[model samples]
Target chain A: MAVTRPGGPVDGSSPDAVSIAVPERASTGPVVARALRLLEAFSDERPTLTLSEISRRSGVPLSTAHRLVAALETWGAVERDPAGRYQVGLRLWEVGALAPRGPGLRERALPYLEDLCAVTRENVQLAVREDDEIVYVERLAGTQAVGVHIRVGGRWAMTATGVGLVLLAHAPPDVVERVLEGPFTRHTPWTLTDPARIRETLAAVRTRGYAVSERQITSDATSVAAPVRDATGEVVAALSVVAHHGNPPVSVLAPLVRTSAGGVSHALAAGRRPRRPR
Target chain B: MAVTRPGGPVDGSSPDAVSIAVPERASTGPVVARALRLLEAFSDERPTLTLSEISRRSGVPLSTAHRLVAALETWGAVERDPAGRYQVGLRLWEVGALAPRGPGLRERALPYLEDLCAVTRENVQLAVREDDEIVYVERLAGTQAVGVHIRVGGRWAMTATGVGLVLLAHAPPDVVERVLEGPFTRHTPWTLTDPARIRETLAAVRTRGYAVSERQITSDATSVAAPVRDATGEVVAALSVVAHHGNPPVSVLAPLVRTSAGGVSHALAAGRRPRRPR
Candidate 1:
């Protein structure tokens, strides 16, 4: 009989929630890669794991998993509960908070994101592209707004959300091509899967300075997104607002999302510039 | 001449911004500890560092630093920029988001935090104690609220702020004793320095189920804090609201803080209890 883990994805079926691709190890030695694989084993769906579960998920021998996990626990990369289950630790979170693309970007954009959420009373999301997928950096829920399945640090396909579209549109040609290739998961009937249509949508996003995703992820919600640029004018992130479908036209939200994105870009540029000499 | 790194503390001076303690090695081999030390070298003041700088700050030999940094880069724990400066990478941030005591707690407490900030128009902070220091997990700044220096993942002394006092008050006796034996830095004239006074304050915090810090961290701010308990009734976190001095009496904020904390406690309890069989 197969042992079942509480939150593990069922066999032969992808988890319908946030879909994050585990980072592939490059030239790192096997020991380091194995340690990282252990870290990757914990996810939004399965935040805690037993030693045997970690060994199985990471594809490391049980003894190796035990040794690596012991090191990780010592270094505070992972913590063990009273019941001996392992989860990521606070020290790792503190170091990760220094990531320029993660908390740093979110910190610079938060005031504007809060402003957008307050003004529209809708869900505001900030995301950046990692590989071909979009990783949500921050999300502010509008208290009484439409329920959203997305969470911070969650990942989704580039064809299924407004932020994803904006990021894919500004991504390099190779990345765009890679994402537009076959094998897309269809979240809803409205999710854009046709390569030609997705290409056309990317072009329109470039022309309009924003993207509108209508009932792509869920039937009751629509999202509008715009690109956030850095000092070099490269689009580094995407900002979006998801609201109840048909309550406000996409045209109405486009300007708000664009303005917020611009505000974030300006803040980023200002922060990057050196102070003038006295 | 001493070579100064960007984020290293100046002679006899503390970096007043974010203070994150480096994790100590716990009987793990020296290599893992050394890699963790390299990560600890990056801070809010110096988010990016050159290879030589990392070597110097972490006190690792250049060849070993290069090897370990290469591994870290491969594992996406660190990333290099065009200028060859290394910073914390997005993959690590994604993993860190799984920490139960960090983003997990913050995610559950955010809506209530937003509501408190909306109603009070004050700086709201959620924090948990790690070792003897207070690590801020979330801080929601109200528009037009008093400016605050605390950031998420930043650490502060257990005697310095409202949330810190609440957490310290409920902490184990040895931890409290360790904090009280400190050569405390006085940020303001009103900061409590006498151990007797601090003990009284702790007792008062326990009795009242709240704490009020008047001009402790900054002269212009007054903070009211309450404890957040888990399902087991353990004080796992603290919630606080910092406002401009003299704007609202501590009495007015105390009840609000306690209520929001209770709401969070209830939410945590509800989340932890096993669901009844359908």
Candidate 2:
């Protein structure tokens, strides 16, 4: 709803060095931010960490980290591993499953996504725009030669991915401007880093009802994406099929991807039982 | 790792009146607990709540709720809906997906779970033990006259469902004792609530290598489950298939369910990629 709320923690950065962590900045840091710092310290790269590591990474004093972690463990937000190290907890996962923009959307779109994955035999992906970045909601790997390396919760800039293009096309104007005025990351020689070229690509995506990214993220894959809309006729997400480079031409794959996206939109519009939380 | 760490916030209670909320109890409430209270305020029934609702539900002061929510929002643990009401956030979902006992285990076991679901065309479930309860990790619905109402992340006592029984049979002695010395909940007339009968049932499960619950949760559904083990051969989770009562019979479903659970155990022991987080 609102990235419009606060700006410090969700930038996908390890905010271990939070603004309040400076001793001179505040004699006593806000406990809430320190708690969040403890959470931010746990990442995909390091799923389990010792209490000492937590204190070091979060920049909260060892004793403060101990007290805060005690509170977190009480809430089932932080759990210990077999080795007495901390990891994310299943209780937190249970609550996270309630996130409307994450699993809530993913669960509704899964059947259609699976259908596309089955029909295409190519990497099928679903993503939603968050601020200027696109976060993958679900991805079904195809049995094709080109196997995608992106995971379900992975994030990527809007410049090099297919779903990212479709989402960027429907994003707010300010978001578009923010993405355009970027220090674009170049993944390959064919990757689009030029702002003008990306602008041209957006128009083509709108006109053709899909997006194509050939040899962008990987030299072996070509991605075609389409927008998935909600009942309000707003594009809430994007779906794509990343196929082996030109094996199934974009012309052949585009309709399949668009149809799947449309099916997901239809499911969203139908107001079906969306794997309702119990 | 250690529910052994703390005990106040996660009894699945709203905890609106945390111990520190009493003015006489503490001059300053722990802000970490207060922030967690704000999180506990959101539920499946009330996935989106206003600032005032949060304050009321958390029992945190109005200004304090405002401050804590700002921090939660910044960390992507909470988000504002289109109507400006708060719901869980995608970043939180991303972090939660890293939980080993939840999605990590489920992702590894999914292929086998799907195989059972497709072959039997019956509801398939995967669950793990949490204290004296079972928490569903994933559930694939089947097209049958007897449809299960349980949702993923839903919890049940170790007495009601097949997965629960299997998990409980393999539980620690103290946990077993804790469950047995209980005012057991009976979901149906067929549900076994007597301690001696439950102990007999546990022996049967260990001997037969599967657990069967007939018309326990619902009259029309009969569930059969098998234990899934880790490399150490510990029962880490349970797998099940809830079928139309007496249709496939426990005889037919048991072997299939056991095979699938074994498959999952094999996958786990392999130290597989496990839908490796990016």
Give every candidate's TM-score on chain A: 0.87, 0.85
Q: Residue B137 deviation, candidate 1, in Å?
A: 1.0
Clash-forming residue pairs, model 1: none
Docking quality band of candidate 2, CAPRI definitions: acceptable
Q: What are the iRMS values of all candidates?
A: 18.3, 12.2
Q: What would the per-residue lDDT of candidate 1 be over residues B171-224, giving only the tens digit for each residue?
A: 999999999998898989999899999999999999999999999878999899
Winning candidate number (lDDT) = 1
- Can you write out model 1's per-residue Cα lDDT over A61-112, one digit (the tens) per residue? 6765776787788889999764678999998999999999999888889889
TM-score of each: 0.84, 0.85
The CAPRI classification for model 1 reads as: incorrect
For each candidate in the order shown, give its overall lDDT on alpha carbons: 0.82, 0.80
Best by TM-score: 2
